[model samples]
Target: MNVESIRLINFRNYNSLNINLNKRINIFIGKNAQGKTNLLESIYMCATGRSFRTNRDKEIINFNKNEAYIGAMINIDNYEKFIEIKMERDKNKRIRVNKTELKNYKELYSGLNVVIFSPEDLKLVKGGPQERRSFLDMGISQIKPVYKYNINRYSKILFQRNNLLKSNKSKSEIFSLLDIFDVQMAKIGTDIIIERAKFIEGLSDICKNIHNITTLNNEDLTLEYISNVQLLKNKTNMEKEYLNKLKMNFSKDLEIGTTEIGPHRDDIIMYINNRDVKTYGSQGQQRTVVLSIKLSEVELIKKERGVYPVLLLDDVFSELDEERRKYLTRSFNEMQTIITATDVIDLEELQNVERSIFYIEEGKLII
Candidate 1:
């Protein structure tokens, strides 16, 4: 899959811009704060229906504008798709594919598959559990669009259950409400847990192999999914176990004013040589772990979707050593890759790749 072109209007600093993308490589070169990353953000939003940098839609709109528009033409398996997203300051965002309006953002997942690697991804290794969870959720949702619906359902049920726990209502009333929420939450949460477990297992295998090659077999990387519920191999049994755990934790949850256990509280742990990478690994090691995971994502998406997802690299080349940079550039030869960098970092590795370079300056592109 590849993006053929992208159009931006009032998005971040880009008041009005339109550009075609190269099938092999498209490089955006510029100084800091030159709308290099903002261009990538627009494409990502068209793919995943959310901004990677901020959750607020209004944040992506130019400060002086009340609305923003992003459109992209993508090719998947030789079929072209046009996706458009419109965001208003106080109104809900609208999404359309081939001129057909979608009821919600989740519907966009089925069309475009993108794997984005940015400096913020370092958070996948060094940041809190929420970061890892977001990584897992987003990655899975791409291959299985229904997974997003399940996650959304689980979140809503969890929210209501937490609100009930925090209420000043009588314990009897809360328990009655909890009874309804736990069953629903467990069913959806169980599906999410099973899906995540499968994805993590596959991702771990690929990442381990990639990390081994990248580090010359000196470091061993492994990924493990940690769930608040003791997950059984069978979904039916796992759902029962989840429901029981929710019931058992109700008293504790009531005391704390929050629902404490479920997929939302789960985490992904990266281990290097059996030690938690986040806790003990060096900065270089953590970076290697994130690199392995991202490359694994590209491979996994291809394995599941039968086509490589478009790769978006946002100013990450500067952080990598020449060896790592060469490794990344080499992969660009196989798929469409859009990269952003302050300046040319590895001209040697870039020599053989067919690429188009655009100098971005304050939201304008100079080819």
Candidate 2:
């Protein structure tokens, strides 16, 4: 998959812009706050139908404008698709692939495939469980569009169930209503947990080898999916396990006024040589862990989709040493990569690689 071109209007600091991208390597260089990362965010928005930087869509619009637009022409499996998004300050953003508008963001997941790595992604190892869960969900949703629907439905059910727990209804009435929520949550949550488990299982295997290579085979890496429900080798009965857990946790959940056990509370534990990377790993080890996972994501997408997703790098080289920087740039030849950097990268790293460079200042591009 490749993004052939992108046009932005009133997106972040860009008032108006249009650019064609090289298929191999396209680098955007600029000082901080000059709309470099904003360019990548626009392509990502087209790929996943959401901004990677923020949850509120309105924040991406220009301060002087009430609306913003992003249009991109992408090629996937040898066919060209036009993705159009219209964001209004007060309403839901509208999306269209070709001329047909998507009914929901879930439908847009398969429209474009992209794997993004930014400075913030280090949070996957150093941050809370939500970040890790998001990494799993976003990575899976690209290849499995229905996974997005399951996530949305599960989240809605979780929200309603939590509200019901906090309501002023009698214990008997609340328990009666919870039975229905419990069954639905179990079935949907089971789907989520099962998929997550399988994804982490596959991603773990791929990340292991990549991490080894990046670390010169000096350290080992592994990932395990942690769920409240005890998953078995045979997942045919996982739904039952999840339902029983939810029912068993009811009194505790009632006391806390919230649902406490499900996929929403799941996490991925990263281990380096049998040691918890989050707590025991040094800064370099943590960075290596995240790098391995991201490279593994690109491989997994290619494995599942039969095409490499567009790789977006947001000023990540500055965070790495010369060795790790070379390790990352070496892979740029394998797929279409767009990078944002505040300064020029090492010329030696770009040797023999086909590339295009664009400079940005105050939302304007100079090629």
Candidate 3:
């Protein structure tokens, strides 16, 4: 899918802006804090109906304004689509597809895919377990929108169960209610774990090739899902295992006032040459691992959905060396890519390529 154009109003530093984006490589050149990342964030928000950088939608609104608006005309498989989102400080965000209002985020999230690579993604390899799990979950969600629904449902149920655990209910009352919560969690969390395991299997297969190329055939990357409960190969046994663990940890969960034996506590482990990258990999190795993972998402999405997801690079080029830059961009030939950089030198190799270049100064786009 390719974004044909985008319009922004009172979003971050942009007061009001509209610009047509190139189908193949749109580069935004600007200094730090000049709204480069904000531009990419807006596109991401339109595609996913949420922000990647901030949790609170109000934070995206302009300081002097009470609302923010973002709209985009996207081309998916040669068909055009219109997506719009409006956020207010005191109200729920409104989303519309092809000018029709949607009741929930799920209505707008399906079939709109995007993979983003930012400096922050370096955390995928070097950061905590949650970081890696988020990376895995999002990569899976882009292709299988249904996975996002299950994830949201699991999250909500988990919240309710945790709240119940924190309440002053008696042991018998808590146990009775916990039985219902555990049943629901086992079903949803099992789906999450199973889908995550399959996605990791696919991601590991693709990332191995990508990591090899990125490292000149010197590394073998591996990815695995690590859950608090043992993952039995049998589906029945898997759910039973999770349910058993939840029961085993119920008392501990009550003591801690949280639901702790499920997918929420799960993680994705990354390795290179049989060594845990999180603990043993150097800075360069970690970056390469992240790059491989991000690029592999593009291929995995294409294979699963039969289309390449749009790529968003937020000021990450400055961190990559020349060789890695070439390897990264080599796959950009046909995909829609939006890159943010501080200067032309940061994207010198692409300067001569057929592309669209825009300069941002104080939130305004100058072509």
Candidate 4:
């Protein structure tokens, strides 16, 4: 899939803008804080109905504005699709496809696919477990809408169970609800674990090679899916294990006023030469690992969807070296990529051809 054009209004620094994009490579050049990242975020929001920078939808609207709007025309397998997103401060967000309002969010995930790489992605390896879990959840949600539904349902159930615990409810009363929640959580959580395991397994194959190329074959990388509970080992024993763990942690969870154990707490561990990369790996190694994961995401999405997902690189070129930059440029020849950077010299040196270059200053795009 490729984005043909994008329209933004009252989104971050962009007041009002509309621009057509090249299917191959479109570059946005601007200095820092000049709305370069905002442009890429707008395209990501249009594709996923979520922002990569912030979680609160209200923050996405320009200051003093009650709402923000983003629209895009995407081409998937030679078919054109129009996607529109409206974000309001006090109301639920709205999404429309081909001008038809969607009744459910799952309806929006059918055709649109995008993979975003930004400087912050380095956090996937060095940051806390939440970041890694979020990475898995977001990718899975895009490819499998059912995972979205199950996640929402499991989260709701977990919330209610936590509330019950904090209310000083009787053990018998809470236990019943916990049993139901545990059963459901294990079922959904196991599915998530299974899918993530498979994804990481597939990703390792590509990441290893990519990391070797990026590091001049000096370092070896590995990705391992780490979970609080081992559910993949025995499907028949999963329910029992889930129930026992919840029971054992009941008092602790009640004291904390939260659900403490489950897939929500899972994480991915990155190792280089059998050592934890987050703590021991150099900055260059961390960056290369992130790049490998992202490129692997592009390949995985293409394999599953039968089309390449649109690639969005937000100000990441400045952080890469010349050799790595060339490697990234060579990797994008088979996919559609939109990159934002402060200058075009590096990009110009990497590839030679007809490309769309937009100059972003303040909130204006000078074509």
Candidate 5:
């Protein structure tokens, strides 16, 4: 699957822009703060219905405009698809495919799959557990729409349960709500934990190989899903354990006025030579880990989705050394990639291949 073209209006700095894309290795070259990353963000929004940089959708609209529009022409399995999204201030966004409005936005997840790698991804290793959980949830949601539904349900239950706690309602009221929420949370959370364990297992296989290649076989890299509840071994055991912990922590949660446990609190750990990379690994090692995980994500998506997802590299070439950059470029040669960089010099080697150059300047694309 690949994006054939993209159209943007009132999106961030891009007042209006449209450009065709090369099926392989399309490069967006411009200086810093010239809307290079914004271009990739628009593509990401088209694919995922959300922004990677900000949770507020209104932030994507132009300062002078109250709404933003993004549309894409996608080619998947020899079929062409048209996807368009309309964002309005103080209102929910609208999405359409092939002139038909989507009844449920989740339906948009069927064909379009995108994998984004950016400088910010390095934080996946060093950042808090929320970032890692988000990585797993977002990837899984795209592959399984049911996960999206369950997540939404789980979040809603968590919100209501927390609100009840905050109100300092009667003990009976709290117990009733907690009972309902726990049952649903365990049901959905168990599914998520199980799937994540499987994903991490698959990722380990690919990451081990990629890490060996990236590090020249000098480092042994491993990924483990760190969970307070051991869900993978026995589903019922973990669910019961999590439920008991939630009950045990009820008083503390009430004092803090927050939901303290479940999949939201789980995380994935990366190790290099049996040492935690987040705290002990050098910057370069962290980059290698990020690269390995992303490549693993690509393979995982392909294996599960049965087609390669579009690869979006946002100024990532500038983050790697020459040897590593070469390895990354060579590895993705067969996949459709849209890369943003400050200059074309780093990518001159691919000029002879099937590629196109778009010069972006202050929200404008020079064809």
Candidate 6:
């Protein structure tokens, strides 16, 4: 999949702008705060129906404008289609594909599958488990849109259950309600756990190879889902196991005012030669693991979707060492990539094929 062009109106720093893009690799070069990341965010929002940088859609709108608009021409399976998304103040965002409104926003998931790597992604290994979980969810959702529904539904159920646990009512008054929440949670949580396991399972081999090549074969990388469901093996029925676990933890959860066990409480463990990266690996090892995982995302998506997902690199390559940068650049040959950096990268070092570089200044894109 590739983005053919993108137009932005009142999006972040861009009041109104439009630009065509390169199918192979398009690089946005500018100093910080010059709207480098903003352009990439526009493409991402168009693809995912949400923002990776912020939760509030209004934050994406320019202060002088009441609404933000993003339009793009996407190329998939030898055909091109247009998609538009507009978010207005105090209103729900509107999305249209080929000018037809969709009742289901989830259609955007398959419309544009993207793998993004911002500088913050460097923290994937050293950061909290939440970051790792977010990485897993984004990659998985592209292939399985139902995974998106399950996660959203699971989150809502978790919030309601937590609220009940913290309510003023006596424990006896809400015990039955908690049971209902557990049933729903188990049903949806099982889907989430199963999907997550499948994703990691698909990603494991590619990630290992990436880590080995980047680290000169000195380290063997590994990934595992550290789920709360102790009997997570496929042999056991997940929903039933989940209900039993929740029941076993009811007293503790009631005391803590939160649901205790499920995907929300799960994590991913990364290892190098059987050594935990978070605790034993050095800074370089940790960053390498994250990079390998990000690149592996591109392959995993291609394997599942039969099309390479657009790659968004937010000043991440500039921070890498020369060897690492070259290695990552080599992968760009096979995919559509949008990258942001302060200085323009030399395409000669990575590609002899077509590439487009846009210089950003004061929110304007000049090719």
RMSD of each: 1.1, 1.2, 1.5, 1.8, 1.7, 1.8
lDDT of 5 by residue, 48-128 (tens): 878899988889899999999999999999899888989899887888888888765555664788899999998899899
Candidate with the larger TM-score of 4 and 5: 5
For 1-367, candidate 1 gives per-residue lDDT tens digits of 8899999999999999999989999989999999999998988888899999998998999999999999999988888999999999999999999999999986676367889998888899889999989999999999998999898888888888888898999988999878889999989998999999999999988999999988989988998899988878878998899999988888899999998889889998889999999999998888878888999999999899888888999999888877778777778887899999998755687887789889999999875
- Among these predictions, the greatest lDDT belongs to 2
The local lDDT score (0 to 100) that residue 357 gets in candidate 6 is: 80
What does the lDDT come to for candidate 2? 0.90
What are the lDDT scores of the predictions, listed in order?
A: 0.89, 0.90, 0.87, 0.82, 0.85, 0.86
Ranking by lDDT: 2, 1, 3, 6, 5, 4
Q: Judged by lDDT against the true structure, how good is candidate 1?
A: 0.89
Q: TM-score for all predictions?
A: 0.98, 0.97, 0.96, 0.94, 0.95, 0.95
Off by over 4 Å in 3: 345-352
Candidate 6 residue-pair clash tally: 0
Question: Which ten-residue region of model 1 has the weakest summed lDDT?
Answer: 105-114
Task: Count clashes in each candidate, considering only residues at least 3 apart in sequence or on different chains.
Answer: 0, 0, 0, 0, 0, 0
How does candidate 5 fare on TM-score? 0.95
Pairs of colliding residues, candidate 1: none
Model 4 per-residue lDDT tens digits across residues 1-367: 7888889999888899999989788888888899988988888877777788887989889997999999899888888999899989998789998889987554567377889999999889888999998888788777887777777777887787778887767767776767777777777767777777877887788888888878888888889988877754786587667767888888788778888778888888898888899989899888988998898888888888888888899888888888888888886768788888888755554457556788999989885
Better of 2 and 3 by TM-score: 2
lDDT of 6 by residue, 104-128 (tens): 5555653688888877886688788
Clashing pairs in 3: none
Global local distance difference test of model 6: 0.86
Give the residue spans of candidate 4 off by over 4 A. 104-107, 347-349
Over 81-156, each residue of candidate 2 has an lDDT whose tens digit, in order, gives 9999999999999999897898876568546788988888889999999999999999999989899989999999
